[model samples]
Target: MAWWKLHKRDKPGSPTGAGGAVLASAAIITRDQVRSVVGKGQEWQAQAWDFYRTVSELKSGVRWAANGCSRARLYIGRVDPDGSSSPTPVDAQAEDLSPDLVARLLAPLEELAGGQLGQSEMLRRFSVHLDIPGESYLVGFDDPTSGDRRWLVCSPSEVTSAGGGGTIRVQLPESQSARVELSLDDCTLIRLWRPDDEYAYLPDSPLNGLQDPLRELRGLTSHVLATVDSRLAGAGMGVMSDDVVPASPQQTDGANPVHSDPVTAALIEAMAASLRDRDSASALVPLLLRVPGSVKDKFEWHSFATELDSNLLPLREAAIKRLAIGLDMPPEVLTGLADTNHWNAWIISDDSIKLHLEPKLGLIAEALTDRYFRPAWEALGVPDPEAWACWYDTSDLKQRPNRAPEAAEAHARGAISDAAYLRELGFSAEDMPDEDEQRRRLLIQLATTNPQLAPAALEALGVRLPNIGQGAATDAVRAPVEISRVAPAVEAPARNEPPALPIAASAVLDDGWRMACLDLAARRALARAGNWLLSRSGRSRRGELAHVPVHEVHMHLSPDQADLAQMLDGAYRDFHAATPGETDLHAAVDLYVRRLLLTGIAHERGLLAGHLAAAGCDRAAA
Candidate 1:
């Protein structure tokens, strides 16, 4: 019989030897038969019920894996004719297809998976495709002018493959009686089965390998719950057994026999009622029964107690560990074990992403590239539609161990630029300071150290310099004048009147002031020589110092000697040019004495020529 004719009558209680029975008996079933059995018929309904129940039961681990795997970032890319692939530009366009430009283009496909379906829900549904045969979604575009050209992603339960498996028919959600037929070219189908010849149509799942562990986990959990319930059932209830003997009959007067007295019986009944009320009100409290002294010895009391074995803890842990092993995740991640340190946690996370998530993400990327992106591109009249593809950015999915120290060392060793170092530390261009800003900061540092370059640096950076006159005015306003005003002015003493000095100068008198002039010149020459030596030695290594020429030292000192002479001449002129009222005699004498002391020290230490000669010895040896 024809496949279509078989599907029309394929019901649970259909006539034997008819179309339905013939199709069921056949070993090789067509797509129409598979769909009729697994899509909309009683079998489909039963499978759907089982599918949902399994999902609900495995909600914790299943959701964890699905959400974690799908949280990866998605992006579009294109393959070059030379076989290289690069991410497509965010603003890329191709005729009427601007996939990146229109945010809503795939919104329905990602979020509107019929009714309240969204990207996460869609991912979860796709993740379960392995549990079922496959996943199917009906695709439809919204109005282009409305800027809502999103494809509708309907549930797979509503879709059924046609006879040849090349097309599908969707039973509308609004009215299950109405059906819309579409070719496979217009739908997005993700099969979890192998594409090879063998087992091509059979569904496969990672969870299949975890069945034994999952069963053990369920059994252990049920045992624990049952144990707890049993303990609770008997908690605080006093012993009640028929093994105890009854109390011996008590002797009493005829009028006061225990069973015959109404007042005594009434009092006993009231006390029993009160005890029952108290026991019921507080279940934790144990009820006590009192007997006559004579009868107490004849009766025995017992206690009912329940204690759960502590060995069950290890069993529970073992079950959980088995589950984690099956899932290929860290035991701590699923069981909340807190013994792991940061380093171990990081290693586990990295391993989980590499082993579990990467393969799944690769499959998803391939599916999106082949089934969705390629078709969309082709519809837009794009040239070489096979060149374009979609991918996920899994770079941020795993936690990278701290590498700041290594990157800093590399930067210090000049192995990487500042930008490259930043990138290694997971920073983008936007996170780093711009070249202009860095340059401005460098200029500011240079100006701070040199002072001479302050104006030029400030001008280059468009920074206005403070006016010199304004600074002078502010300083003058803050100057101290109260001390000078409070003290009386003292006139200079006579020069020959035995000048009162802080330190007595050498009493050696000269017929001319030639000695004083020579002393001043000597001090100035020593100062000039020290400054010249320091400047000439600029960054010279100890080994290189021996290679310097003696002539260079002599040449270096000549210009400094000339400068010293000019400074000495200027000082002499300033001293001689000063008016008597402007200069104090004691101040002039003190300055001459200090210069004399500096000259004596220089002559005694032989710093006048010996210092330069010693430095030039290295050069002389060379």
Candidate 2:
């Protein structure tokens, strides 16, 4: 005996199984028993199974619909505490945890849905809740040996709700045929459904509600498929009927005559075989049908082909539209029939996202927030878990045909802030400048353009400046005064005092004296012009010419002083054209004055020295 035949056969009812036959029989009996148990709730369960099977058959289309509906981003936000029901930015800690939690949830979902799945897959799996009454999942460790847990979305068939929806029993076939019964409170599951009054145990799915339309769609699709097969099979090909040739050419005898001679028949067979053998590598090869020479002129080949009508297209499209209506999805999305114009496309996309996708996303988001986010945040010690909620940010996903121009107009009209406008344009918070920073920049710009307003701006900002003088001086001084005064004052006579010198004596100045006085005035004006040039140079060198005030060097100069002032201004500008760094304007003016005074003194000294030298030379000659 072989080793395989050594074991003894066990009885049917016995637990012990030594033979493979007993094990095989037990497996068969167990499957049959499971089926028998499942068959007890025949009517509703059978309908549910039918829907599941139909969805499976249309898996690609169903998946596409689900994905199109789920292509929106979800974010965590804080619920307003004042009962406004408005969302606010999440608290710092919750905001920090949101991305990690989102990533953690997404990673496993992608793994479960295969790595190609994204936010769309997460919502698609949750969409099963829309197809079935509800879905239950086992939230357990990803690795049974490890403590880390994840949600495994299971089929409705795998879970059996019992005790009038109090406790649910889950049978894990992969885990030693384990059966676990859990109370509603203990079960960690998310249920997504549309509310209605019809069913008591579970809500009705879109699948159930739209069953008739779906059936019609299925029938239409079958008809289209059949039509395509028929066209491919025979409609496009020409068939030579027995009566296609004139009756005069056919034999009148009751006995059937051969349709064609051996060579023609062989050619016809070859053509038919070529057409039928579609899988053959040479199916596309050109074929030639030859007729015998004696009968060729007498016979004519008459070909007939069934006409393919365009009428079915509209009917099939109408059926698809009905199916789309039933699914609560846009027809364009499901059928891939789109409007050519950008405006129409945008309108359709916007309507679908707002009217269809958002509501569905909201259901999923609420469920996940309650079942997944709350517990996770609580575990991480986040505060006020009740106030925190998850929501979909469909703003980015929505098509905005007029957003650019609208945002620009709103910004120009001061209807929205710069940051808000940028956000509408899809800029993130981190990418925009803060309001306070923007205000500060604006103030700086205003001050640069109008330096006289700098003091007022600083005062508004609550800056305190040192008092120039006490009460009297504060009243007297109305503007900022320069530290150095370049212009000489011509003081008026006191009220009661007489002129310093007799009016006649003051007027009786010599021509030489008047010329000398005019010369001094000219030098003074030149010095002032030099000072203005130096100030300009300083401002330019500091790279703050826009910020610096323009000094009017010729302000106090008389009409007679204009020529020398303009000449000196031009000369000074030309001299310092290439000079770098800030020039000391006051210093430049003082240096010019000292040089002018010293030049006169030097001339007088030179005259004295020349006279002394002449006297010494005379003494030496004597």
Candidate 3:
């Protein structure tokens, strides 16, 4: 239960001692709540968070995704491999990351993520805060030992303000009367971007974009619960009039007479839990009832799952897929690996690091580098402070299970190539293992085997094995790091200023707009879909501009080829039948639709103009 030395305001989580009384009672009054001190705002709304008890979609997906990036072993400062000050030795065992200062940073990072329990405990809270709220206000505290700053990850809602000159005002937990204004030298803010909003003071969570799907998920969940209750009540539903009573906890004491129905409810709940698998062959979900003798005859024994499974369970998966898309994660990452084969599951693990984790870890690492660690480095009067970048090693994320047997089987059956087999067994293409290690237990069968040597096998493929002579493995300080996995945190270029995109189709072309019947409901859905599309398709739309013809660009931008146009069309169809109502999302929807439509129109215009200019140049030459 080693805790990060957080600000004094974070006392509620502290062990009962000096701050015991405060921990028991003090309430955190944040900046959002401070607005209500003078005005009569919604007391419950201000006091409580968006979700008092987060369950299902938001809780599960966010936490699962966050876990991938939670245990980031952050290192700062990079020295060139060829440069002075601890250059990588001539041997293979040399440390890739030079400068002992950079290496020593791991200790403090471990302590920072180490919350009341273990290393990941604090990081889990930090990651959850970032994932759910879309922001983590890391209030910096000066480390007396290292002369650096360590941060306590605070909720965005809890921080009243983080203004100029390192002033971070945090809402004190428990029943604290006043907010605590901690005068700090450094504060790092990690923000997940809100779509099309460059100037928003508050950022958005990955969950924020998936609001509609989440609402559907929640609504569907409630509908399922109500349906279950209806079904459960329907069991002895009409027969409850005799001596039977709906048992409360007090009514259902310990014995079957007092609380047999709740126990029956518990059994039914367990049965329902077991049937969540989409491919479950179990058609009949049995409902056993314990009731009074008068009601026993009327009680209908039924299995609701097989009957209703086709209608409902798949809808939940659709919502879950929406969550996965919004989070930029693979659907299997959220739902579980039940649907995928073993090789695909293995590929998913690797893809989890590439698709999902790298971006998040890079963001966090960059923020820590720029604001948290760099400031401390500058304060120490170190030169080239900004040159030092916070980098992450995700060696831990790569769980290297013994895949040799699987690889051997696959390769033996000609299902995979030699290189693929070696890679499957966790050996890199460049720096690979020896003959015996690569062959596993099959070194004795080299004569029986086709390739007589791992070295000779690789030799045929033009891969030269580095001769370490002997004792080279024990001499290396750092393990042969996959250089791809070890990289500097790259901060995305400033996109605050709006890109000069094309005009909207609805406004320009008389018949350009595809969604003619879009109302408020469709508008929100359109906006969500448009934003989802925009978030994935980044600023590099012009990549195809150089190679392809102008007509191809138009076709690419068209609804047939353009993903945004397709998304807008789908959203309209999905929500066209909905009861319309106005929301702030509609405003964003309008903006996004315009932007998405205009982008294509704009590109077409530019390309057309260029094509005409090229033709004119040829005609003038003629």
Best by TM-score: 1
Q: Rank the candidates by lDDT, best first.
A: 3, 2, 1
What is candidate 3's lDDT per residue for 229-257, written digit by digit as tens? 44333232222324434333343335444
Candidate 1 C-alpha lDDT tens digits along 1-622: 3221221222356442122222111122224344543354234334433533543334555556666665666655555557554556333544556555344333323433342334545555555443332333424433234634334434446666665655666565457586666543433333323122344333335454555656665666666555443322333223333443333334456864555454344334333443456345333333333444444345444444334345667876776667666553445566775777876777777777777766666666665555445445544445665655566666666746776766776787799888878877989878887888889888876565333466798888788876676443332123321112122122222323433321112222221253344344444444444444544443443234445442123223333322332232223333334333322332332233223222222231122122222222111222
Off by over 4 Å in 1: 1-58, 78-121, 128-198, 230-237, 240-310, 328-332, 335-339, 399-442, 449-452, 459-622
What are the root-mean-square deviations of the candidates from the true structure over C-alphas? 18.5, 20.6, 27.6
lDDT string for model 2 (1-622, tens) is 2111111123356543221222111111122233232213324435655655664333444565467656665556667778575455444345456676545433332332233334455666666545554333333223334433334454555566554434555665568576666543433433334554564324455556656655665666666555543422332332332333322222234565534555444334434544566565333333323333444455344322234335656766676666666665566765775445865788777777777677767766665565455545554445566667766666656757557666776786799887878877878778877788787777765454343576676666666767754443321123422222244222223334442432233222333453343334334444555355444343344354344322223322222221232334333343334332213322233233333222221112222222223323111222
Rank the candidate models, highest TM-score first: 1, 2, 3
Model 3 misplacement above 4 A: 1-52, 77-122, 142-150, 161-181, 185-201, 231-310, 336-339, 403-622
Clashes of each: 0, 0, 14
Indicate whether candidate 1 or candidate 2 has the larger TM-score.
Answer: 1
Candidate 3, lDDT over the whole model: 0.46
For all predicted structures, in order, the TM-scores are 0.48, 0.44, 0.41
